[model samples]
Target: MKQKKKMTSTGFLLLITIVLFFVMYAAGMVIFADKGFAKPQMFLNLFVSNAGLLVIACGLTIVMITGGIDISVGSVTALVCMVMADLMENKGASAYVAVLAALGIGLLFGIVQGYLVTYMGIQPFIVTLAGMFFGRGLTAIISTDMIAIKNKLFLKWANYRFYMPFGSTNKKGKFIPAYIPPTVVIALIVVLLCAILLKYRKFGRKLYAIGGNKQSALMMGLDVKKTMFKAYVLNGFLAGLGGFLFCLNSCAGFVEQAKGLEMDAISSAVIGGTLLSGGVGTPIGTMFGVLIKGTISSLITAQGSLSSWWVRIVLSALLCFFIVIQSVLASAKKKK
Candidate 1:
């Protein structure tokens, strides 16, 4: 009965998020029809622009589902970008080598932070806060200035686009093919893999159990600590991959790159219906959250007069709203 209730609540939250996204997007299409908000390319641009955030949000969802938070992901992304930029631009490293280095850096942080949180029993926020500082400090140490990536391979990856069979026509009546970069493909794959892991894998079940109640999970003979450690490690890896994708989009790196991005990831997961208290989230829902974010940004840009900061403002409002909803549902469950 409890399981059914959990499933029902999860579905309810996800449905709300999906409906909200469509409603907001429809409004944009109607209000900005002259501005091409209805264009297919405009819709595709959301994914193209936010692929990195999508991947990072998936990682955040995983950690949050385990009742943990990592505020260091934004710092990690900055560090990864700076390191990759320094490697390929200055040290003459191949893009492939730089990519491997990014993954290694992420793994190193994951191992260290995960060990601290799981084995040492340190609070996750404290440990990741220190991590956040360390990562940003290390990024500045690499170079405070922006390093633009001029590597051929890296540029090739950034420039490459896959065109769709269908698209909108231009003023000249020429069909402009809608396209996406490899980053979108990677983000979508991450979402699919994470959804599968949480839904079908034993490890995922253990995570859910631990998040629901640590003592109960222990009673069930689940390796709670190890599972949490693995969760952080996986999150770190995704942070690295997401940072790389972000770099592909920008083709540059600086100390301030991806600043405050951690909040964006957290908000995306939350707005997607991932409970801050843990044990409830879906990657598919998170994807829609990201799309919602993208839609808001696009809408603001289309409006032309509104400041971009409105995106943050609206997201903050939405975040608070969902958190309240989650609390209410949780309270009602307790009463039942």
Candidate 2:
């Protein structure tokens, strides 16, 4: 009975998110038709542009599912980007080596943050907040100036595009094939794997269990601390890879990189039907949430008159809307 209730709630939230995305996209298509918003390439750009955020947001989803939050993801991304940039541009390191460094940086943060939160029983917010400051500070220590990655291999990966068969035509009636980069492929794979893990894996069940009720989970013989520790570790690794992907897009790194990204990830997860209090969320829903955000940006850019800050205003409004819905549902459930 409990499982059924959970499924019903999840499905309801997912349906709302999916429908909202399509509605927003459709409206954009209608309003911005002259700007080619209806084009396949335009749709694909959403995925291409936000591939890194998608991955990072997925990691946030995992942590949120366990009723824990990590506010340091954005800083971690900055740190990773700075480290990679320094290694490749200044140290004459190969892209392969930089990749290793990215993973290692992420793992190191994860281990420390996870240990603090789990073993030492520190509040996740406090631990990750310190991490956030440390990461940004360390990034500045590496270099105050920006580092543009000129590594041939890294640029090759960045510039490479996979063209789709169907696309729009130019004024001369020539077909223009839509293309996507490798980052989109990687991001989508992460989403799929996360979805599968949450829906089918034992670890996923444990996450939901602990988030739903830590006491009940402990009574049921679940190791709440260990599971949460693993979640942070995994989130750290994803944040690292996400930073790499974000770096791929920018191909440059500085102290100010990826500022406010933690909020974006958190909002994306919440808008996608993940409860802030925890125990309920899905990667598929989060994917649509990301699309909705991308659509908002594309719409604003196409309008050309609106300030970019409007995107935040609109997103905050949507975030508030969803939180209200979640609270309403929670109240109803309690009453039942």
On TM-score, the leading prediction is 1
Instruction: Assess the local accuracy of residue 102 in candidate 1 as a C-alpha lDDT between 0 and 100.
Output: 92
What clash count does candidate 1 reach? 0
TM-score of 1: 0.97
Q: What is the C-alpha lDDT profile of model 2 across 1-336, one tens digit per residue? A: 233454676678878899999999999999999999999999999999999999999999999999899999999999999999999989998999999999898888888999999899999999999999999999999999999999999999999999999999988999999999999999999999999999999999999999999999999999999999999999999999999999999999899999988988888999999998999998988998888899998999999999998988898899999999888878777777
Give lDDT: candidate 2, residue 302: 96
**RMSD to the native, candidate 2?**
2.2
lDDT of 1 by residue, 211-255 (tens): 889899999999899999999999999999999999999899999
- Which residue pairs in candidate 2 have backbone atoms (N, alpha carbon, C) closer than 3 angstroms, thus clashing? none
Q: What is the lDDT of candidate 2?
A: 0.92
